[model samples]
Target chain A: MSLVRLCLIMLALLALAAAVAILLGETPLSLGQYLQALTHPASPPGEVLWTIRAPRVAMAILVGGALGLAGATMQGLLRNPLADPGVLGVSAISGLGAALAIAGGLAAVPGAIELSALAGALVAGGAVVAIALRLREPEALILFGVAISAFGGALTALVFNLAPSPVAIAEILAWLMGSVENRDWTDSLRAIVPMAVGAALCLKAGRGLRMLTLGEEAARMSGLPMPRLRAYAVAGAALLTGAAVAGAGVIGFVGLAAPHMVRALVKDDPRRILWPSALAGALLLVVADLAARLAPTDQELKLGVVTALFGAPVFALLAWRAARSWRS
Target chain B: MTAAWTLNGVSARLNGKRALDAADLVAWPGEVVGVVGPNGAGKTSLLRAGLGLLPLTSGEARLSGQRLDQLTAAQRAGLVGYLPQDRRVAWNLPAEVVAGLGAIDLPEVQALILARDRLASVGAGDLATRGVLDMSGGERARVLLARLLCARAPLLVADEPIAGLDPDAQLLTLDLLRAEAARGAAVVVTLHDLSLAARCCDRVIVLDQGRVAAEGVPGVALASDVLARVFKLDGALVESPAGPVLAARRL
Candidate 1:
């Protein structure tokens, strides 16, 4: 049942990605023309369709899927529905990394920003785990994450402030706001490998997580080494966050909102819900990106702004429902 | 006939506090041992330490000649089943799914043995599809007890297994434990109900202030003036329909 839904959702997202790429630009193409563009390799439309729009569409899927999977994985590990890389300092650190690369003029070398973003994500993720380890309570770890995220945000602002040119600041700001515009196949490849590897590792660790949900002692009693299992899950989240942030500056809510929404639908069966979560996350980002591109404005709004606008209210509704249900 | 477990001067400390002090115990196979104690008397600590769930400050516990820590969880899993106090499982899962957890490695036939006989034994056969969170306290207790039995381990360590259970469920749970011991498992349960302990257990060990205050046959152990003194109760035995029951009245 879940597999069929996942396939359909992936197909729908693929359709949306193609639509966003082909129809949202200066010269909008009809479905027939889009098909013409997709097929006719020797024509100018082929280069325009394949080169510019295809890579952007591909990047959207990869970044969206990565964020969604990572978000769901984070929620499962922490047992918190609201947890995501953005709220937990992952994207802020990635922003910091991207800023440093741009501010230091290293993006001229190509892939520097991606590397820096990955590094920042790793550092932030490691710091969260370290802080979580130090604290006696899970709530303490969340609070500490907020504190770390604030610090990273401040550092990011400092790096942006020190940029030598307005162009650099504009680029950094736009990237931080997150968009799939002007991306290429090279960028998609940079993100896909790490995200795929990370998601695979998370799937491998899913069984251990089921044992973990039974509580630490039960997990230990069930033959799981808690420390190692936690490390693997944390590392997987960090890697996925890094890849997504590296691919796009920081798309928010895909990580926090996706898994919770999936759980809300699937009824919290972790083993069965993983792919649904990943696909749902991908579909969310694709739709959000499409909205960002197609909004009837002179200038395109940021993808993050669209997702946050859509996701926040939905998340609030869910939270309210959860709270009300919890009371009952 | 064989000793299922032996503790040699086993001690446990938690955060610099001596929770259990130099405890020695021998659990013979196919015997039901009940541990009774006042609150904070280190009863749970002793069981947890013996099961190798907690670190021992000193001494050691052996399970059928094997060091407790040396056994892998799966290997030890085959030897002992431990049910802790206040097990908080997500109630959204069905009872059978929770029961399925205990049927980890046993052959299909053995799993069937548990599902059929043990569920009926604990009076939880009707609750196979019910959600644990949705069940009444008595029902959840029966299901959990059934899960413990499904492990088919040689030893059972249950901390307050009958707390919050209704009288009928409590009796049925005890009866199930007795049947488990008859199947050649050493069953150790920490309990608050003195009458249940007296009726169900072959032997009893009472703890007070982190030490074994008394250990022996239920009647003799509960009859000890020392237990009355430590428990600060007007201890008396009542002849009940079930058997001779210990009645502890407030001093």
Candidate 2:
């Protein structure tokens, strides 16, 4: 399909996904009732729609979009298709920060989770930055991110096992697993500013990232400053990932899935894939949230689990194809 | 004409081993300088150091009278373009996109047009839209050559640029380098082909064991005695109608 047609399809799917999410929740509101709740705020359906579902939907979309754009930015900067916010330990660090806020009673204060998550993400992202800068070859940076991810995961598990209360343990586990079940507009409001700013920065850095696809020597000759550009991209990725994690706990595969799927749709042009990836990511998470809310099972699936279940196989297939293409 | 670059008492050492030892060289505007050496003779190291990507162990290299390390990335970019020995395209991005990236001010269409015009001057226009991944080795070389040209910098440093080209393409590549020099750009290329160096470069530097064994016009630098001692080959310089050529026998 042509790029324009593909973009139209992506947008249409997003709209459909949003509509389906609105109609399929546990409250079982029909399309008309949901429409009434959204358009006519004073009606009987207003409480159900405005109070609970709207915020949930908005939170899902915002967090998903953030993860998607962050993933795309990371992949482009690293020049490695497999790189993602979660895979580099950025999310784990953010989760640690959120857990600290909740467990330490900081969440009693308004807006603490967001600040805590941002701190965690910055710390984790900073470690990756330091390591990437230390390496001479780009491949070494990839390895370093992998190492950081593994170490971060271990640290998170240790912290969870040491929780003092059953409630604390459950919250930590739920956050680690990733969820959007009880999130409201406040969560989305908390994240929107950083996500928007970070995405804008990523888009501005898109041109430089495209030049870098030709390798460092070529990029330098094309007028890119290696050290500064690398720092800019890494900071952009961290901010986007940090905001998403702060708002919605730690959604794992959205970042990995969104960028890869968008690349598949748009042919790996960084400039073309930027916004589409964000939109598609928002769509995917909204749909996943809908499924999590209304599945036949009593226990709702976590948002992260749904994405990981769906994303891992598709991601593997794309990665295999990429490797084979490179080999040839 | 002003000197585009100069290296004085410069040396490069990697992993405690001397890669380039006390090398002194100067390239003027509109000059074609070729460096020839064996595999470990430090041709790539010298280019990297000169470009300020690598620091000199001692002494210094300068671009347009400013020390290379003192120049900002943009200032250096306006001064020099470097093509490393290995060029990789991480994705199957279109070739025109790659070349157009060097245009500082034009839109993509205008950049492509300007890049194609420059490529056409070097016999490389037809391959503009081809994917770098799908191209043949010679075709990739030409595309990268187009990319190098698009920089429009005063100095061009290409390391083993023609290693993958066919014989005919090799000659065209040399001609392109000559044309770049003729346009007032300082051109430095490292090559395994002595004949191409002898035919194209105004001056040649021959390196042996991390030091300059010979430096001068190609005919004088590639003399039989130097080739025999430094390159371990017995070579004769024969006067052709066009110029002097080097014919060598394996040691």
Candidate 3:
């Protein structure tokens, strides 16, 4: 299929999923109420649609698109198909920060925990980029990121272990499990703005990533600014991943799977894969969230858990295909 | 007259080892300068160091008479293009996409047009839409050549341009390089194939142990004794249907 056609299909799919998510939440809304709610925000049904479903849907879209775009950029930057937004450990670092805030009794404040997560993400991004500038090999870049990710994950767990009370522990654990439920407009804005900036930066760096398909030396020889490109790619991904984690709390699999799902449709152009991957991610997350809502269980399935259940198989498939043809 | 590209008393290091030392080479416009050496003799390093890809440890380099260090990357790119030794591409992108990457500053459509034109010039026009990863080594090499051509810079540096090819493909690449030189670009290439170098190049520079050992026309620079000492081999220039080729043997 043509890239344009595939992108349109992916966008249409995402829109359909989003419409379903918004129209059929805990309190199903008739088409009239859906339109009426938009017109009257103060009514009870309006509050459910606007305050509950709409924001949740928007949060899903923002988080999914951010992660998917970040993953595609990260993969292109590293020249590795196995890479994702979390490869640099930014998500875990942000989670650690948010967990620290929650355990420190900051969950009462609306945006304080997210602010902390953003701070942690920036610090981690700087540290990783500092290490990246000195490293001569891409393998070393991955190794450093993996190390930081492990360290962040361990520290977050430690924070969970040492929470002052059972309530703090539960809050931290819930935040870490990842979800987009019951989010408001303010919360979505917390992520949506930074994610937009991050997406723009990644898009601008797309051509450099395209040049990288020729190999590192050739790309550099082609006059690409290596350090700047590295910084932009890492920083942009950090912002996107940080925002996603802040809004939805460490959703995985979408970043790893969305790009791969649309990769064949785009002919392996890293830059070209960004938009389709974002659409794929948005679609994936909306559908997953819907599944979570409608599943026949006592408690709702966590968004992260559902993604992992499906993403692991995709991960295995990607690994299998990567071995067969690195290009494809 | 100012040379198209020049490296003066240049040296470079890789992995804490001296890969190039005080090597000097200058290629004028409208000429193919073949850099020939044994394995690890620093031919690649010389080209890289001179092109300012690898920074010089202790000397100077220039493109079109402009000091390389003073030139912005874009300015340098405007002056020259490079084709490194590795022919492997990291994606399954169409050949035109890969080729258009060289001219990315242009609008996408214009770049693809230039890339397709370059592909046709290299005789790989039919493969414009083919995925580079799916092509055979020879076909991919031609696509890479098209990418190099897409730059359309006046000074072209290609390392080991004819490595790992059938005789016909090797001849095709050589012909393309010569064609670029004929179009008034200064062509620099590295080759282990002495016969092909002697036949295709206007001048040949021989390197041994990180320094230029001999440089002149192929007949003198690759004269028998120089070949024996530097390359540890004996060689004789012989006439073939294609051209004069240097047939070499172990010492």
Candidate 2 pairs with clashing backbones? none
Cα lDDT of model 3 by residue, A1-328, tens digit: 8778888888888888988887886677787887778789888888987788889889899889988998888888777786775667877899998999999988888788878888888788778767754665555776788898899999998997888899998888888889988888888777788898889888888878889888877887787676677678888888888888888887777888989888888899998898898888888899999888888888999998888788878877876777677432
Docking model 1 quality class? acceptable
Please give, for residues B60-149, the per-residue lDDT of candidate 1 as tens digits: 998877998899877787777778785665324556555655666765456655665666667777777666667776777777677777
Give the per-residue lDDT of model 2 (tens digit) for B1-251: 66888988888887689888998778998999999988899888888878876778987999888888888878888888878787677766667777677675567778888778776766767777667778877777777788788888888889998887888898888888888899989999999888788888999999887788899998889988988988888877777886666778878
Models sorted by lDDT, best on top:
3, 2, 1
Compared with the true structure, the alpha-carbon lDDT of candidate 3 equals 0.86
- Native contacts kept, each candidate: 0.18, 0.60, 0.67
Ranking by DockQ: 3, 2, 1
Docking class of 3: medium
When sorted by TM-score, best at the front, the candidate numbers are 3, 2, 1
C-alpha lDDT score of every prediction, in listed order: 0.76, 0.80, 0.86
Q: Residue-wise lDDT of candidate 1 within A1-328, one digit each (tens)?
A: 4557755765676676667655566656677776777679556766677787678777877887788887777766765555678878888887889888988889788779878988898888888767654454445656677787799889988977788999999988888888888888888887888888888877877766655544455556654555676777788888888888778787877887777656745546555556777777777787777778778889988887888787778767655754553343
For all the predictions, what are the DockQ values? 0.36, 0.62, 0.67
- The list of candidate 3 runs beyond 4 A from truth reads A1-8, A28-41, A108-111, A122-148, A224-226, B239-241, B244-248
Best by lDDT: 3
Q: Which ten residues in a row have the lowest lDDT in candidate 2 chain A?
A: A132-141
Worst 10 residues of 3 chain B by lDDT: B242-251
lDDT at B237, model 1: 68
- The residue ranges of model 1 lying beyond 4 angstroms of the native Cα positions read A2-26, A100-105, A109-112, A123-144, A158-169, A225-227, A264-267, A321-328, B106-121, B136-138, B244-246
